[model samples]
Target: MNAFNEISKSTAAFFVQAGASFGVSFLGAIGGIYFLPLDPWQRLFLGMTVLFLVASSFTLAKVIRDQQEASTIRVRLDEARMEKLLAEHNPFSAA
Candidate 1:
């Protein structure tokens, strides 16, 4: 386990693949909206909704990661305190 950051980092290839996938999916959604037989107003609305969904998804991901990191830090602190307490005590020693 890494002392600095308990969580492992994603690989560069994973990042590249994720970026490419996001780009392709976003473009595909926009293209689909463009080629739809619906009215221009409807297409525009759908595109705006999709954009909002993407933004919200990113926000949610950030919040979840932050919460996870906070919990991990809390657990690490608790563990350190427990270790210190244990190190200071000995059953064989007279009180």
Candidate 2:
């Protein structure tokens, strides 16, 4: 169990670091391309940039959705706990 926990933590940290690095480098590339001369090469780079942005946007949306679901679950758990406490406080309240 200890080894599993450590491995999980390390893997999560690695992804976090990788994501940050990728984000920064991706932004830098997009910025650099803006100053490139307008030619077939520049157009190709722009097309690729748009594709990357679209793909990342889709991925981010899915992450947001999963997070939203998790948040809802937490909210429901808290509500259940609160109700349990309330019932304990008032047996006749018909909670």
Candidate 3:
């Protein structure tokens, strides 16, 4: 119900999906390598495989980084807000 919980749930979902996609792509790449003939056309498949692998890796990194950043921001923001509320309510603090 809270912002932090919501963010965590969505971020977890994204990571799961990203991981699944990466796995599928990896399997497909392996299959493609084996099915492609070793002719000039094979170069095309090789290029595509390389590009797919690179792009998938980049995508995975970006998703992980983004989720990490989001989680960090949520934690810091919650901490700041709690600190502010605590400061406001504390009877021991000097005026």
Candidate 4:
């Protein structure tokens, strides 16, 4: 079907884009390391430090996102409880 062909094309395009982005980023990192004036050991240390920082940042972001989601869920639950209480208190309600 035409839709299937379109889906396949889009998937291929996504793969190509991802590959290109990775290649560019890899080259840029290599170039940056090569240009640094630090000794080999220092460069290695710095690279490792940068990687650790990046990993930590990703972890921190996930934690923050999870906390936000939990707070949102709590808020919704509170709102639902309040609504139920209000309905129960309404004198005009046909119990």
Candidate 5:
């Protein structure tokens, strides 16, 4: 149950971050189209730049998220190792 809750929370957070990043990128593209006065080639360049930025943002977010999740897993493993060591050290328990 706790694991399910954690999964749901992480999934929700991921979607929220993705949605927000996409929304901002879209708005930025729209704003650029409306506000920038440029030639055809310039507009094309701007469009490509915006696309690259959006893609980069998503990739960066995923990388950071994976790093954080890995860190959490490492911490949990360390905790379990410590617990096992403590158990082994207990004089009252039969080995």
Candidate 6:
């Protein structure tokens, strides 16, 4: 039910490895495009396309994360309301 419980902490080494992998992949793509014997206009278009893809990927990740957070919050709210109702109930009361 806690935010901390939902997220596991990453070790420094793991964090570094992830970052390095991403950097290598992105740079490799760009470097490969740069070395190709194509016209400048073609290279520029490829570079722009790659950048746009990266941007869209980031945006998509953010959207997914936000949706997950929203769902978790909604579940927590519903749980709280149920708990409050349970706490206020009197089983022996006569109506």
Alpha-carbon runs more than 4 Å astray in model 4: 1-30, 92-95
Tens-place lDDT per residue, model 2, 37-89, is 78878768796977788699879989997897688678978998999988779
How does candidate 3 score on lDDT?
0.80
Q: TM-scores of all models? A: 0.88, 0.47, 0.55, 0.62, 0.71, 0.87
Tell me how candidate 1 scores on lDDT.
Answer: 0.93
Q: lDDT of each structure?
A: 0.93, 0.77, 0.80, 0.77, 0.81, 0.91
RMSD of each: 1.9, 8.1, 6.0, 8.3, 3.8, 2.1
lDDT (tens digit, per residue) of candidate 4 on 21-86:
867876677679778998999889878876776679779979997897688679978998999998
Query: In terms of TM-score, which candidate is strongest?
Result: 1
lDDT of 5 by residue, 1-95 (tens): 66734663757688899889878869977687757888878888888888788789779989998898788889988998999998879788777
Which of candidates 1 and 5 is the stronger one according to TM-score? 1
Our model 6 lands, by Cα RMSD against the true structure, at 2.1
Task: Please give the distance, in angstroms, between residue 62's alpha carbon in candidate 4 and its true position after superposition.
Answer: 0.7
Candidate 1 residue-wise lDDT, 1-95, digit = tens: 77646345888899999999999999999999999999989999999999999999999999999998898889989999999999999999998
The reply for model 5, stretches above 4 Å from the true place, is: 3-21, 92-95
lDDT head-to-head 1 vs 3, winner: 1
Task: Give the higher-lDDT candidate: 4 or 6.
Answer: 6
- Candidate 4: residue pairs that collide: none
How would you order the candidates by lDDT, starting with the best?
1, 6, 5, 3, 4, 2
Model 6 per-residue lDDT tens digits across residues 1-95: 86745584678899999889989999999999999999999999999999999999889989998898789789989999999999999999997
- Write the candidate numbers in order of decreasing TM-score: 1, 6, 5, 4, 3, 2
